[model samples]
Target: MSAPSAPPLKLLPLILANAACMMAMNAFIALLAPLARTLALNEWQAGASVTVAGVLWFLLARPWGRLSDRWGRKRVIATGIAGFAAAYLALAAGIHWALLTLPGILAGFLLLLAGRGAIGAFYAAIPAAANAMIADRTPVERRAAAMATLGASSAIGLVLGPSLAGWLVGGGLVLPLYAMAGLAVVALIVAIYGLPGGDAPLAPRDATPVRMRDPRLRMPVVVALVAMGSVAIAQICVGFYAMDRWGLSREHAGRVAGYALTAVGVALIAAQVGVRRLQWPPHVLIRRGAVVAMLGFLVAGFTAAPWQLIASYFVMALGMGLVFPAFSAMAANAVAAHEQGTVAGTVSAAQGIGMVLGPLAGTLLYGIAPAVPFVVGALMLASIAFWVGTAREPAVARPADEAA
Candidate 1:
């Protein structure tokens, strides 16, 4: 398959579509804690919703990508979006089963699989496809900037999305979730009319189809998993921790968490600008992110104050912001045109796993000690940083031009 040739300014609609979808996805996430409380679940279970969704997102992303490769991205994306909207509507309306069986897991799987799949495929595939699309259309020398443009769309969407959801949902989980579903519908419309359609991008040639087996991805994937895992774990525990530690009420916790997340969004946007100006190698940027994230976790762990946790999160976000873009850039550079979706989806899968594990790790540690989760999470991220420093990378043909 050849790349889909984009029309003038076609990238704008693609970005707008992606931004809308992501905003909805995250807005719904911001409502998770409240949703759990309303459903009478414990903190752990509340966190589990997100963890479960992330796992679903990470695990199924590639399958969706591969499907898109064959069937066409727009079709797969629209299907995913429709399923996602339905799943949320069901969840919002409250679906509970009295009995546990093969069907119970199956039921839970479908709910999350459909809801999460919309995001996993829609968000993951579009970016990967768009990046490749941008790569195909832009000259190689300027591809990095196009990729940068691609990255910015998501960042800008995310920066304001949660707050928007919270304001819309105000006090109800259903409203926020419905808002996400509505956005998914809107995204589907945008995709149908706004997105470019042409011949599909290339597919895997027979040689080395599935596995790159490259250590370049290994180090970054590890970093992403641990770092994202820590983020996920903290997301689960920190609300309760804030309440317990600072005597904050549920509403206060929600407000504070929203604010902190917004700060994270801001940090990521700052990173986009900062990275454009920096001359650092990708590895260096990742390491810096790891160290900052480690510090944030450690600070949050030791904190006796809510304000400290908030402060620490911003610091961690700054580092993470630096690393995330570089990681994506490196992954894009590592593969051939045919395998872009596969590789990008594979990376997203790792992210999903980290998200799933984050809460599980936290819950396990919570049973032992409340603070244990943060410390362990910090150590996990730190270890990944160390691994990256030592890992022997694959012989990726450094592009004739750097991603500068």
Candidate 2:
């Protein structure tokens, strides 16, 4: 089938809502180390907070996707947005109290963990439903480009979040946290009022459950795990890398980290723009993007100057922007209409698992030596690129419901 003339107008609200949430989340992540210091927590503790939240995200994302299939995308998406707003506010409040009251290290650590865990559990709903909605509307031949539009929303968020946080952080660390909460509120409003209403079409009760190890999904799942795992590790460590490698102060490191992350976001947007124009098949995009990402990591592992480090981050994210949409399109095209929701959820679950492993492993390796993790990450990406290039390309087949 030929692609649609244009995506439906209803996609605007979903795009806006997802962008807002992504901005809030990435902003917080960029400022994690500085925020951890303010709350009297250590590096390990901060990393643990991400690990716990990722655990919840990984465990629940599939179920939430399945729920969206039954409960309707708008309702599930709205609930997720509402929960995101509430959870962010609660986290901000907890941080404020910890700062004022001088909570013990353990108390402060647990507070951040609980707050992040709550946010992750709900935030999983937003992306899964939104992606499934796009899958519902787009045909197989156009799937990658449509998915690229959604990925662009995330890239925009990544761009705005760290840039805004870096600017606001000069006022105070807490200021950025509050700003994130405000974005969530705006997203919640859009999700409630702007998205289409009514139920998603139901699938049969006995539709085969999508599994992580399914033949159709195995390569995509592996790609999600490696790509996201590398990104998470790099993100969680960049601030510390700035401080230690460049000899910047904590505050200065925060600023530098923000700038570096903003570079990543810009590159992501640039690459996705290429994806839209080039319209490469899923296999080609996956293979080429992976090779680019591996080169970026290799540069990052050995760079001697701050400018070089930032450049490497830009290169890395540019490649990721290509890989994400391509893999998502591959997975969606491999599944049936009724299975879109579950597939999207399973993809997210794989990403969550990557998040869970990346930070924990990254931090530990960093403690041993700053460059070790990046070098290892480079090798992992190289391996994946080779694997993708050697594998046979999956045939894109339209589902009966979609063809009709």
Candidate 3:
């Protein structure tokens, strides 16, 4: 089938809502080390708090996705937004309280867990729910475009969130957290109002079962893990990279990060445009994107200048931007309509694992030399291009109800 025309209007509002939540969730990351200092946490203790949040996300993603499948998408998304707002507020309060009370660091560590968990669960609302929402509204052939747009939402948020938070925190440490809360509120409003309503009709009970041997369903998941890992490595370590590499001010780093992030978002939109044109098979596009991402990282790791570093990220994210949608759409294409939640959940869990593993790996290698993790990450991502490019999933023809 030929690809559908890209819906410029369908793209904006949903992405805007996702951006709102993304800003809230990621802003805390820039504050993680400072918050640890307020609670007197060591590097390990501080890092552990962030790791725990990822674990919760990894654990809960499947179950929550299943629930969204059975129940509905909007409610779960709404719940997550509210949770994000609350957690965003708590980060400021927790740090302020820890600074005042007994100087014990455990209080701040606990606060990180509580706050991070809230943010993780709520942030989960946007992508998975948006995937399902897009699935409900679009045809199978055009679904990749929808998923690519969803990916851009998070990238847009990443671009905006840090710069906004850094400016606020430049004014006062507590200010950024409050600003994140405000963004979450706006996201919640958009999510509640702008998104289309209700669950799609589900497949009947007699649908054929999923088997372990189903490459159509499983390969893209593995591909997602590889791409998500690269993204996570960048996500967790970008702030530290700026400070260590060039002695740039946090405010300057924030602005630079914003520019890089916007470029990445553009890459995501670029991929969506490609799918709209249906010029290449998704499998080919995915491998091409991964190759570009790997090269982007190599460029990033070798940069002698900060602008070089930012430009490298642009190169890398552009590659990843295309890969993310192709893989997600591929996974969605392999499944029955009723199984959207299941596939989405599994893909999410895989990405969550990558998210956790990437940071934990970076922090460990960072202790040795800051450059080591990026090199390793680049190598690992390069491995992805080979593995996925060679693997082919055979399409199975199932009954309409079974393919639901």
Best by lDDT: 2
- Arranged by TM-score with the best first, the candidates are 2, 3, 1
* Most TM-score-accurate candidate: 2
Q: What lDDT is reached at residue 52 by model 2?
A: 81
Ten contiguous residues with the weakest lDDT in model 2: 395-404
Root-mean-square deviation (CA) per prediction: 4.9, 2.4, 3.6
Tens-digit per-residue lDDT, 1-404, candidate 3? 22222232365777888878777666676665555545666656656667666777777776666667767777777777777777777766776666667457666678777777766766665566667667656677667776776777777676667667666776755678877888778888887887655663353567554442455656677777777777867666665677677887655655555555555655655655565576455677687888888888877777788788778887887788778887777777666667676567767777777777777777777777767777887887777778766665343222134423
Clashing pairs in 2: none
Q: Please, what are the lDDT tens digits per residue for candidate 2 over residues 1-404? A: 33333245366788799989999998888888887877778778888888887898889889989988888778988998899889999998888788788779989899989999998998989878888878777877777888888898898898899999999988877788898999999999998889886546566787778777777787778888898899988888888888889888778888878888889889988898789899998878988998898788878877797889889999998889899998888888877777778888998899999889998988898898889888878888888888888876643222334443
- Candidate 1 per-residue lDDT, tens place, 112-229, comes to 4455544443454554455545544544334444555565666666666777765765544456666666776787788778766653455644535445355546654666567668
Looking at model 1, the pairs that clash are: 58-349
Which stretches in model 1 have alpha-carbon errors above 4 Å? 1-10, 95-149, 169-171, 204-207, 212-216, 390-404
Residue 13 error, candidate 1, Å: 2.3
**lDDT (Cα, 0-100) at 259 in candidate 2:** 82
Model 3 steric clash pairs: 80-122, 337-404
